[model samples]
Target: MQTNNTPQNIAIIGAGASALFVSIILAKKGFHVTLFEKNPKAGKKLLATGNGKCNITNKNLSLNYFFSSNPSFIKYSIENFGYKEFLTLCEEIGLNLVTNENGKTYPASLQASSVVDVLYNEALFLGAKFSFDSKVENIDFKEKAHIISGDKTYKFDKVILATGSIAMEKLGGCSSGYELAEKFGHNIIKPSPSLVQLTSNDKEIHTLSGVKSEANVTLLVDNKPQKTLFGDLLFTNYGVSGNTILDLSREANMAILNFQKVDIVVDIFPTLDKNKLLALLEKKKKILSGKDKNSLLLSLINGKLIPFIYKKAKIDSKKYFIDNLDKKDLQALTYTLKSIKIPIDGSKGFDSAEVVAGGVNVDEVDNKTMESKKQKGLYFCGEVLDVDGACGGYNLHWAWASAFSLASNMK
Candidate 1:
């Protein structure tokens, strides 16, 4: 093993968020760091984050924000590298940040490219080398660390795998990172598409396509309420896509993999309960006694969605007058409005997924340093690990946190 004071040769695969962060840290720590990216440019996915604004980090850093097969695996790295330290480093590297009311931090310039540029510039200035269009194909860790990319082979004292997951192929996401881990005797949890749009077979969903609403979404796995999230939801010809659905999708993906029943229960009127909504509808019915059922819902709900809502309640919009509606009709409408269950068959797949849910099992990696337990001089971090975070800036936080932890322990 190299001594703490000695400069070690380090190889990092993939040029995503964690790769860049760890490379910057280790290079500044006097290590000779070389980042190998398959793509012509680094941070291709990073450039697309937060719609180009780049949600860099969250002010509230907690273990609850992250998900892993080993749930507590993120605590050590996160405790070592919190948002304050990350923000300080960002400032030192000349990247100004702004924290909004929601505690989601972004570049003051509001450009994801700006964040990536600052990180790349800092790493380069610190003497870190970058090899673009260099996709690593093989790793021979039998004797020394030898990584072969095509015909060329590079040896290193230590290698860090920061290659993300098989999500968003448009951004160069692939399974090479997981294959590397498997070669080193690490077990990988089968990856599934998370934070992606849901696909449904419900024909009614097609009619309400393009309709957006603020709603509470609950994911039911095996007929149990696994999780809930609140945000804006959008109906598409495919199915449901939005902040709320993406937040709840991790559980949906996992459940689908288990062959368990998966369903999305959306409460479009989350602020009002069943009884309250029923009372409101009753009062409205009295006022609009002569009007048709469609007219009564027009002022209260999205016109495009009125037909679907009434149909779910078993009420005929064409025949029923507001006064003719019975208790059963009101109850059905209340329940439908409060709990509109949409059966999710599958996701949009990795091509449309924002992040993947599984990776190199965290049990095979050290939480403190993100070093692989199965091999010396090998490390893992970011989405390549089992750890994944919710939407907003949590996933980026994991990247920085795990990278910082690994770099600190590199000799």
Candidate 2:
């Protein structure tokens, strides 16, 4: 604890979640903290999170939810600063928090600005200074922290790099964070867009566009099933987007980048087995004997998607009677419904990505303290690190947890 009249000067790059939280904590700890943000305002991307509701954290935080080069890297920070601790801080700061059925925690007001406002207010009250529109072009750490922004130079005793990732460039995302880490002897994992929509070359996608179905999606890498996710899959004009697609996109994007054959297979009827579906279809054929094939499928599937399924199953759309449908037709229909493969060529890219998959490799940073192992006084936190979590407030939780860990270990 510093009892001296002069507090130690600390500089933080980027005014995102990690930087803001740490600035508040360090300022309260008697450190002179200064935040440099390239954007005119802080937390611009934060306001876009949870569709602008600002999902602050998750009650279902675990190692499984996080993805990294070292999966266990998040354990120390997350365990030290759990969800309850963050909520306690929010309550103390007069911000109301509410957790939904999915364990996603948000402000009671449900306004993202409210979350940013409270943090900004508390940090300012604790004497933390903010330098908006000051993009740090170069950083020299030979002695004390020397950060250069255009013609100006700012020096501090310690610096924290929280520039985040290259996910949402419109929200001030860039490669500067990785560039700075590389210059400081840190190896960066080739960053790619994650939690983004997957684009398919399937011609049927256009026909099925705007149609949503509760289904199970299986990600296939190199023609083999790698993982499975279940949710409402939304068919867009370009491809698929939904909770499941976003969840599987991290791995899918990586596979696509590696030039591997990536595909998404949807089980449109997840609750029904192949036999059950076949039985149901047989019964439908009998009950709707005089109806057209399209009309027979209206109650069974999305009306717009019937043509695509029929095309895949090689069933003629003009087949009006149940007597026209043979055993082979029933088999093909069942197979197509159970295993609808859509070839994923790429994603909607970083602009649409919720988060990024790669960053400064976690091995180069001490998970316990969030301090750079290569540079003693330099620290890292949040999305800038390799750690990324699934959707539903996991990434925000990591930001708070990692920032808390960094602050706890600060001198």
Candidate 3:
């Protein structure tokens, strides 16, 4: 704590969640807070989160939901500023929050702008200043923090790098934060696209585009099963997407980066086992005898998938009638339905990614204070650090929790 009468000036780069949050906290503590944003307005990315509803945080505040090269580094911040604390903060800020059965908490208005508005308003009301269209190109750290934005140079007592990550550049994501960290001797873990749509080279699977089914998706890396998730599985012209795919994308994208073979085995009928599915098909065959084999699966599955399934089973739908199908044919079709392998060639890249997997390595930062061990008065928060969370509001929670921890210790 400073005993001097002089007020400490703090400069925060980026007007995203963490920056806005820290600004409010520091400003309320009597520090001069200035936020430098490249965009014309704050929270451009916040407007796009949760499909514009803005998933504020998750009720289930589990460390398992977050990932980092230095995983343990996030434990202190998350555990200290859990969901309850975040909710209390929301209440204090006059934001009405609602949580669903799945634990995803959102504003009652279901508008992301509501969140941005409240945070920005509170920060401004507390005397925090905003420098819109002022992108900090670089920072020179010495006796004081010097920020370079275009032709202007501004100095401050402390600087916080909250520039976020380069996940969605269209929404103002950039490498400035990481570049600044690297200059201060902080290591950067290579970043990869996370929670993004995957791309497949299987042109045959592409034909089934626009088809969605509730099923189990198993991610196979190097011919071995790595992880499995159950939810909506959408077949796109490029590859696959949906809730399950986005959840599994981080591991898949990381594997692809490591030059490993990545594949997703989609079970169209997760509720039924192979044997039960085969029995069901046999029963359908008997009832639909003499009708085209295609008709056997008419009401059972999507019409577009009948041909695809038949092709995968190596049975000609045009030639085989229900009566012409034998027990072996039914078993083959059952197997095909149980395991529809789609090879993942790549992802939609950073532009389409919801978040990035890696960032500035956290090993050099004080997890409790979010201050750089290499540089004094320099702090990091939010996605700019190598920490990223799984889908379903975990990332946003991290942004809030990290900023909370940083602000609490700033004095």
The clash count for each model shown is 0, 0, 0
lDDT by residue (65-166, candidate 1, tens digit) is: 899999988888888889899988887899999999999999999999998999988889999899999999988886679989989999888899999999
Root-mean-square deviation of Cα positions for candidate 2 versus the true structure, in angstroms:
1.2
- What digit string (tens of lDDT, one per residue) describes model 2 on residues 1-411? 566788899999999999999998888789999999999999999888889898888988877898898988888988888888998888887989999998999999999999899999999999989999999988898778898997999888888999999998999889899999898899999888988898988877856889999999999999999999999799998989999999999999998889999999999989999999999989888888876677657878888888788889888767766668887898899999999999999999998888999999999998887889888788999999998999989999988899999987887
Off by over 4 Å in 1: 1-6
Candidate 2 collision pairs:
none
Candidate numbers, best TM-score first, in rank order? 3, 2, 1
Q: lDDT for each of the candidates?
A: 0.90, 0.89, 0.93
Expressed as tens digits, the lDDT of each residue in 226-338 for candidate 3 is 98999999999999999999999999999999999999999999999999999999988888878988998898899999999989999865566788887888899999999
Output the better candidate (2/3) by lDDT: 3
Off by over 4 Å in 3: 1-3
Alpha-carbon lDDT of model 2: 0.89
For candidate 2, the 10 contiguous residues with the lowest summed lDDT are 290-299
TM-score of candidate 3 versus the correct structure, residues matched by position: 0.98
RMSD of each: 1.6, 1.2, 1.1
